[model samples]
Target: MENEDIWPPKCPECGSPKVDYERQSEYTGGGYADYWDEFQCRKCEFTWRSDKKTSYF
Candidate 1:
């Protein structure tokens, strides 16, 4: 319930609510990338998008 205002804006890799702009690790073949997706967790470094910003993968 840390980020209740945003509800479930969490990282699936670490369950952290520290999501932000996609990290540079993603372009370097970080193993997590998607079409139209551009968000990542500052804690676990997981990347993803949602809703209208959802990924094709």
Candidate 2:
């Protein structure tokens, strides 16, 4: 994806704009699991995820 499509999300805890995308994981088998992309805040060390099957990043 292009850089514009994968823009970093803000930190929910501190509302910091200096957030970074860490990684992503998706369930391969037919089991129940959530697809998500991990992110971290550079300012506060806050971590979070976007639990969507289809992610922009």
Candidate 3:
């Protein structure tokens, strides 16, 4: 695995940098509530979720 693969989340089917953030949701019913972010690939139309929250503060 290269450094780029270990960093940004890429489409598993097609490797493309044309990725877009879909939306964000909060899960409060789980054990530990967390904010998740959704992403989609413009080239392949692949979608994925990430739990790494971002703080603007």
Which is the leading candidate under TM-score? Answer: 2
Q: Per-residue lDDT tens digits of candidate 1, residues 1-47? A: 45465644678788887777532322324444433446778897776
Better-scoring candidate (TM-score), 2 or 3: 2
Note the clash tally of each candidate: 0, 0, 0
- Which candidate number maximizes lDDT? 2
Candidate 1: list runs displaced more than 4 Å: 1-8, 22-37, 51-57
Order the candidates by TM-score, highest first — what do you get?
Answer: 2, 3, 1
TM-score of 2: 0.59
Lowest summed lDDT window (length 10), candidate 1: 22-31
Instruction: List residue ranges in candidate 2 displaced over 4 A.
Output: 1-6, 30-35, 54-57
lDDT of each: 0.57, 0.73, 0.69
The better-scoring model by lDDT among 2 and 3 is: 2
Better of 1 and 2 by TM-score: 2
